[model samples]
Target: MSTVPLIRGYEVVIGLETHAQLSTRSKIFSGASTQFGAEPNTQACPVDLALPGTLPVMNRGAVERAIRFGLAVGAKVAPQSIFARKNYFYPDLPKGYQISQYEIPVVQGGKVGFFVGDHRKTVNLTRAHLEEDAGKSLHEDYHGQTGIDLNRAGTPLLEIVSEPEMRSSAEAVEYAKALHALVVWLGICDGNMQEGSFRCDANVSVRRPGQPYGTRREIKNLNSFRFLQQAIDYEVQWQIEQIEDGLPIVQATVLFNPDTGETRSMRTKEDAHDYRYFPDPDLPPLVIDPAWVEQVKAAMPELPSTMAERFQQEDGLPAYDATMMTQSLAMARFYEAARDASGQPKLVANWLMGEVSRRLNTEGGSIEASPVAAGTLAALIGRIVDGTVSNNGARQVFDALWGGDTDVDAVIEAKGLKQMNDEGALAAIVDQVLAANAKSVDEYRAGKDKAFNALVGQVMKASKGKANPAQAGELLKKKLG
Candidate 1:
């Protein structure tokens, strides 16, 4: 029997802090454009630039979005939450202090469940709050001096904080991915890591069972899955080495170097007292009515977990296949189309997992941008099910269907690809194949198993693969014996 790996009584404790930029068209405090990839400072307005005599105004859409996310995660939405001031001195922070929810957050005390190693693990969420993001500081030699980009300033971000429930770097990474999927499905964040819409920071520490946790370190240079895994792995080992030596690990902020595949300490980690956090009088507290929370809850779409279960039980898809399809909202819709068109859920699962995904991944195309429409693909599958085309012939028909050359019926008729399931025609081809391969025929008569396959191949080739394989196999056996 295989055994699960252990860490010699040392458990890795992890927590994730994920920040996602909302998808609204305008910034949180001003009507300035929230569009990314614009010229530096072009998207800035008086509110975003922190000009004198400017006041902050909350965006209604941003609040409605936050409540939607809170309900999706089963979090408790506080009827009244206060926005506090977090003071800091960074060039990126034009306001010199960020408007954020500190003590009483908007949503609190929820749990997210995921499966790890044949069991279910629930990660406790401490709180999720809405906050305005700081502007980006660009350090480049374009004009031989550091520059600034206020385009991202004043953007609304949902900061999700989870309790220390993860036991490995892998589990922490999985939890991050789960959150990523939920937010994307909710249409709140775009989940574009390359463009910095979604960012993750992991807090890692080592602890003995029934003992207090060690001094934890935070890593921020990881954004993608591969880098997340590598950074956590490096940090855990580094913590272990520090404890093993006489040196105790210190609490601090750290940066990960993807090039070096290691994490280095940036500065001593600061406590809340270090920032001197106080309520910003300039901005009022956030208030949400209970009725508004109910409104947002009722508007949520079908989440992944619920949809996957329905697909497995109602649509008769395997658990693995259903999980894969529902992981992406777009892919799930495509699978439903295949099922709706053919009414053959099992057959649709096979084609989706095998051919459709293969072509999409090969061409760097998504299901939304596919040249083959879902309804058209469904029509092609129906032709295969009705014996209008053999398996090999189905590929050609699909190519034509997607290539703008012909529809399903046109491809079927143009290539003469209808299956010849008649016993009379199959028997004739089987007889001719056995007589031509007399050596293999004699070997099959003497109980040689491989010889049966050689004769079957010849029968298929003789009919140009339009022959029904099952009928041809039976007829070939009768003629050889």
Candidate 2:
């Protein structure tokens, strides 16, 4: 049995505050382009840089996309909400404050249900709200200097806060991945981890089950799921050691170092009063009418968990296969295409999980960029099903077809990869092999092991490996008998 470490008769409690940048065409307030990788400060807008004399304006697309997410999670969309100014001074935050929703977020109280190892857990979301992202500070390779990039400033972001209900790192990762899939499916966020479009901030603490909670450490800006798990594991162990040494945990903001597998303090954790949050008098409160909310809700796409269940029930797939296929929207679509074209859902799953995924991983390709078209791939499988080629022959055909450069059937015919199914054709080669290896043939007649396989290999070599294995075995057995 596996035991929960640091159980001290206590459990580790965690909450995740994940931020996903909405994939909108424009900044939340300005018409400046939201495209990434621009020259530093080039993408900065008058409103984004918090230049004086600029009035705050809302982005309708961002608001609508946020509503789509709230409805997808069955959350409550508040009819009215205020955009408060979170006061903090940093070079990146040129305005000296971040315009964010605090007390009255746009949505509240929903649950995200997903499966992990056959068990389903519902992670309760406290709220999801829209805010403007801050600029980035480049600290590395600056030679004792720091560079500020305002490219991300004022870009729209949806901050989803989950309740402290996760028990393990795997559970936290599952919850984070589920939320990531949710935003991507809704077309609200790009869900790009390497680009920092989607990020997780984990709040970790340990407590005796029957006792009150302990001071929690907030680890900010964990960019990958693997890093998230590592950060949580190291933090939990650190907290347990501190408690055992009679050292109380400090409430502080920390950063996780994936290279070192450690969490270090960044700053003391700040309370609401620390930022001196106040309603921004510059911007009016957002009033979302019912009709508009309904429109956004109606436009919402199917959530991932729901789609996964459908793939299992409707596609007649195993739970694991369905779950793996539905991990991303694009992958799920690819599976559906192959399934529809070939009418072989199980084969589609196997190919996707096996060679297809392997090649994709090796070449750093996505489902959208795969060289093999779905229809073409399904056709190749059909050839194998009809016995036009053997399994090994199918692989050669696949390689030729995978580049989208060659016709599969033409490749097979050009290479003469068709199976040698004629009994007479295989019989001639078998007799030649048996004649060449009389001692082995005599041993086989006397019931010696491995003689038959040796003879079979000879026939295969004589036919240049195009001989059908089953038919060759049958002819060889008849001749030997």
Candidate 3:
């Protein structure tokens, strides 16, 4: 639980339902291809179209992915689960019903722990069940008519439901990001929001503190994190305004318009009974043997939390640094490679978090696409540690390295960025600086700390920015005494 701040004399409660498309080559119940960007209707087969005399068969890969997720989150993998038919009608749902889990879900009772700007928060998960996806409705190119694309029909999905634990939009975004990373890290989903591989629906409501929970409106299909935050913020304000104006908040399903940044009602909300869920006679009960679960546990990769703890104990990294390093598998591998090569954990962590991260964010690039390789970054850090370059000089070298330079030593030498390590030469430069800045030296002897910094700056300037600042400060202190 998080210590949520009150918004306008009311407490905002939020929960999220996320749909993650499983990374299977074929559909969940059919053999149709699941690749994206194909001719829309061409991918639909007889089973996907729900033609007469067709039956549904389970995809083993999809079940394995659900098991992997359950183990990762410490959730219970139910030995027996059943599927039900959720009755609904829409243009894209040719079957007039959806295959989903209602009573006994595949995964039950887990919690996702994440950080909201250094304050740790955990959101409890109610359930994560396997389901099939509905197709898309195309209206743009239909010339005032609507088109149905059944390509996405029968695609496997894991719908994860959370408790009403999140209290702020910022906290919700962090939780979403953490969930996205975990899915991608587990290789269960691609986690591509733009391609509709992952989507979120936020259930938002507001109430006076110490009162019963307010009626929640479900904001649907928020594909991006920015949109997720914006939709919740708008919805919370709208609910608060409605209550303050003496109007009751209606429970409904809403869609968020990204262009206008507002939510409009789609339909009145329906409870579980409205869907008329019942056991699907076509599909049998899904039963998992204990042996299969044990096999999966043996094959499971080290999870992020476990990896972060290992980084803290083995590499002597702080908890925050370790968590950041394990944000993705690629990032963790990069950090380890650089740390091992440089033999300096803290220095590598600082450079990665500060300079490397800034460059990646500016270019909208991932760690895998970074121009500087791990060995190259390690070489640069090595130079800084060996007194071959100052921190300022190292930045210059990094800039060149990022611009396609292959050799670190060559760049440092070619740009004359090496620090002045000659003891006699540095002593002479410090002596000249002390002689010139007589007033600053006198002020430093009289206990003015700023004066000492000014004198060090003068020495660095006299040495043409090649002086090691720490060494110059030591020499200045010795000469002044």
lDDT digits (tens) for residues 306-403 of candidate 1: 89899999988877777667757888898898789888887887877788788887887767877777788788888777777778899888778767
Best by lDDT: 3
The estimated TM-scores of all candidates read 0.84, 0.82, 0.97
Which candidate do you rate higher for TM-score, 2 or 3? 3
Candidate 1's error at 176, in angstroms? 3.6
Q: Candidate 1: where is the Cα deviation over 4 Å?
A: 1-13, 49-54, 111-122, 142-144, 167-174, 206-214, 233-248, 259-261, 396-406, 412-418, 432-458, 461-464, 474-481
Among residues 3 or more apart in sequence or in different chains, the pairs in candidate 2 whose N, CA or C atoms overlap within 3 Å are 7-10
Compare the candidates by TM-score and give the number of the best one. 3
lDDT of 3 by residue, 93-123 (tens): 9899999999999999798988887777889
User: Higher TM-score: candidate 1 or 3?
Assistant: 3
Query: Residue 250 deviation, candidate 3, in Å?
Result: 0.8
Question: lDDT, candidate 1, residue 59?
Answer: 89
RMSD of 2: 4.6
Per-residue error for 76 in candidate 2, Å, reads: 1.7
lDDT of each: 0.83, 0.87, 0.93
Per-residue lDDT of candidate 2, residues 88-189 (tens digit): 998899889999999999989899977777777888999998899999999999999999999889999999999998988989999998888878888889
